[model samples]
Target: MTETRRSEIPPTTDPRPDQQSPAASFPSADGLRFRPLAAADVEAWLELVVRIAAFEKAPWHAQRSELEAAFSDAVNPVAENSVAGVDADGGLRAFGRVVKNPGGDKAYVLGGVDPAWQRHGVGSAVLAWQEARAAERFAADGQPGARARNYVEEDNPALRALLAGAGYSVVRYFSEMLRPLVDVTAVPVPAGISIVPWTAELSEAVRLAHNEAFADHWGSEPRTAEQWAVQMTHEHLRLDLSTVAIDEAGGDVAGYQLATVDPDVEARHGRREGYTELLGVRRAWRGRGIAPAILTDAMVRFAAAGLDHAALDVDTENPSGALGLYERMGYRAQRRSMAWDKPL
Candidate 1:
């Protein structure tokens, strides 16, 4: 649920195609070289991410294909919006990327340095480059009230300190929750509602319903068709395990639950987990038990598929009382992360 969507900014008269790469102006890092990342660097980037995850005791890691797909993204193509710091031996030591939301109101700074390279100013250099890139994008769009954002694990004091020093303040907190699949219970669909298996034909409908359901959530923006297509076709997405709830009379989508299972994460952790990547109930459909019914359906399907657990992330202060609902449904908080922001 914490996943974000980026959209193409409005065309600018000054394309600045020949402008220098942000990496070219990055702060100096001893014995390191900086450059924009490319498709060829996906493998090294995945390795770097895995190393950082292990060092930080993080529960998740990225797949190589995900990194490759990031390079192809039109909104923030790696060749243009990414910077990689490499050691003398050409090993990736640090990296940064800036992804702007569809409305140009917020840009996310995503990257980290290898633990071995920490305290050597590599992180600061990468952060500086990312912030500069975010500012440049905001200026090009000429939007007011734009800001740069970053999410850090609650346990990561170093990165939190870095952001604080750079004038960013913590704005929100999110919790990663996990529910075991043992003794799962089924919840009947509320009267006049039908829960159906997710189908390719219903993808667009689900996306629209999603946008509407999240319209009032903090920091949410509508996902364009292009952005929704990318998520719908992602390698880990499991339509077979996903479900959609429809209003019996109107036949409109009332709620949905999109599922995913990352084989790489399963292999690394030695357990199968069905991730509820996105779940929501339309505003008008709230308080009808649709959310829990869909969640129970997913847990039933996940258990039937031999998955060990179900997982999801929710904003700590979700207006819909999502955290309370999850807690009541047997989910326990496994980890926490903080969102930090700085006005552009």
Candidate 2:
């Protein structure tokens, strides 16, 4: 649930997009000074994310390429949407980004602090700064009721405490699932449906079908063309390995399994992982077994590519019984991530 969203903060002279003045930098209780993250800081920022992940024993890992893409205009357009805390030693201790979800109904604040700096007000300052930016963006749109959300690992008590003390309430839970690709069995495509390799020409139809499929899911929103383009052009998107289920009768995208191969996953985990990033079946195609067929096809493709495993994230409370379906398809829970939110 630590996914990036497009922020809508307006352009400004202030280094801190949410703050009234450029000089009003975020100051920590210690000597750390917060500043807007720059293009040059991508590597160090990714290192901080990896550090926190290891400290928290998170099953999923971060990649510099992914982080770089997220900070670009295609994802988070607001330059000041992200903040970083640097120590006198020239090390980044904490970071935060206020990303506006596609539909603008909610803004997600995603960040983590060095364990050593957790109780010294670093986390609090980063969270407050993110909230300020989100509030400013919401007010600019004249939507005072917009919500700001934060997702944290269930085992991270410090983060949970900071969020609760800041007035955020638990809203949902998500599970990170992983499945070994060895001996993956493929499921047959349903009648009147065909599984095809993802193509640039069919990207729009696939994107629209995905949004329609998840329209009823919690916090779901239709993806803007800009957002959809980001995924289609993603650095690690494996177009050949991705599966698109098309309804032959109507020539519409009925279901899809968009997979990715992170260059850093093997380097960090000692094994290659093919991530099933998005798996959805349109409402008209639900209960037709299209989802599982598409998902299993992706796994089979991963195995054929010599990958060690497949990974995906799912909301545990999905009304479509998605969690049960994934488990039945051989995916097992690897870790838990939680989502919390408060109105802006």
Q: Which candidate should be chosen as best, given lDDT against the real structure?
A: 1
Model 2, C-alpha of 232: deviation from truth (Å):
3.0
Model 2: residue 94 alpha-carbon error in angstroms: 2.4
What pairs collide in candidate 2? Answer: none
Give the deviation of candidate 1 from the true structure as CA RMSD: 3.7
lDDT of each: 0.80, 0.74
Candidate 2's C-alpha runs over 4 A off are 1-27, 74-78, 101-103, 263-271
Evaluated against the true structure, the overall lDDT of model 1 is: 0.80
Per-residue CA lDDT of model 2 for 210-286, tens digit only, reads 77877777876676665676556666778999978989998988888888887777877888998877888888888
Question: Candidate 1's residue-wise lDDT over 1-344, tens digit each?
Answer: 23322111211122234443443376579989988887788888999998998898776655554666675566676767888898899988888888775445788888889999999988888888787888877766677776889878899889899999999999988888998898777888899999999998888999899889887788776777766766666678889999999999999999999888877667677778999888889989999999999999999999888899998888898888999999999999988888899986
Highest TM-score: give the candidate number.
1
TM-score for every candidate vs. truth? 0.90, 0.84
In model 1, what is the error at residue 344, expressed in angstroms? 3.4
Candidate 2: deviation at residue 112, Å? 2.3
